[model samples]
Target: MTSVSSKKCNKEEYSFVYGDEAVSYEVVRKPAVEGLSHQKSQRKIAIKVHPSCEVVVIAPEDTEREDIHKAMMKRAKWIYDALKEFRGHLEHVQPKQYVSGEMQFYLGRRYVLKVVEDADALPSVKMTRGKLLVTLTRFNDGKTSMVRTLVSRWYKARAERIFHERLSELVPHATWVEGIPSFRVLPMTKQWGSCSAKGSLMLNPHLIKAPKECIDYVILHELCHIAEHNHSEKFWRLLTSVMPNWKEVKSRLDGLAELYLNE
Candidate 1:
């Protein structure tokens, strides 16, 4: 394999020839694993293909280029398959207009938007009779921006409450976790949830649009990170010990991303 490094890029991204094809992937340097040589670390090189077909390779800072290239080649088929599937999903994603009659998702169920004009009532959003009802005062015009803001605020509020509840319910399963980690709900582009070494958890507010089972999967996944920091075999074992059906739940959660992630 031949590698061509990019000098102008801020990130450590490179283009390489794998077989007859040339591909570009971002390189992220991570801390080296303890008790293992630089080259022999099992996670010295790890690959992730995002829903946008962006490829990233995480490696130890001291790892050689040859090791990264070899690892990428070993996962060539899986990478191509993932890219193809992501491309298919992208083709069907239409931009939302935030208009009346538009479809919205909450907790794995679809709800139709119903906008109403109420001169005496304050602008608000709520679910009534299986549909999302947005009541606005006459002083405010029913613009897309106004509608989006109302809906976004509603989702954020619900996400905060639901995420906390789910975390509390699942904490009992993960006995390794000592104290409850503080959590915040925010918008994230590339991940469902993340945990910091300082015992803080950040959850993607968009996850509220997915099913309860899928939401639980994300919470449990981050909780496992509290005990195991990296995506090592031990991390998977700890996660499996808590939720045996996490694999199936994770697959379903991945499939729901295209529907919720508008941008």
Candidate 2:
């Protein structure tokens, strides 16, 4: 049995061939469980395809090379499907220039970002008449930067308010969850939300642009983590118990990650 230090990752990146494509992936080892343990065959290997189209294999630190290899092989098909879907998201979303007529999303609806430059107008971002109006007074020097800043701040504020409300609304459903768990909005390129072992949550502000249902899904997913902590069978069961149609919602969200995450 090997003990992995929390400060360091002892495993290196690994790759395996799938059909004609040589897929590459990274392995993130979790610390071995203390005292009681499951059999090697029963040991869980959690495979996740992130919004960034990165494949991550998470297994207990003491897992053997052969077990990890077998788990990867078994999940090869799912990995490929997830990769293709996420890749399509990236390929389909048009790059943003932060200019007028650019498309943006708010609560599952698409809106055109109309950059309204006015030397006398107060700098602000407001949704009006099906358009995201970014009014600016200091637009001459850094027009694009200003638009980005104002929009990002607006999204953060919305996320803070919306996430807390949804968390409160959904907390009662997760009977195992104690009170309201603490959460914060911190933008990340790779994940929509993550939970610490201590039960605090870190959510992406980009999630604010997604539909309210999708937002609820992300929040509920994290709330499940409060009890399960790992992506094991228990975790999935807990998640499914609350959001029976979570798989559908997750797919829908993944399909739009490219658009929602675009700067």
Range of the 10 consecutive residues with the lowest summed lDDT in candidate 2: 1-10
Poorly placed runs, candidate 2 (over 4 Å): 1-92
RMSD of each: 7.6, 8.9
List model 2 lDDT by residue over 1-263, tens digit each.
12121233665577777777767777777886666466852478888888787878888877886777787888888888888878876776886888999888998998999998788889999999999999988668789888999999999998999999999999999999889999889999979999999999999999999999999999999989889988899999999999999998997898788789888
Pairs that clash in candidate 2: none
- The candidate that wins on TM-score is 2
How much does candidate 2 score in TM-score? 0.67
Instruction: Please give the lDDT score at residue 94 for candidate 2.
Output: 80
- Listed in order, each prediction's TM-score against the native is 0.66, 0.67
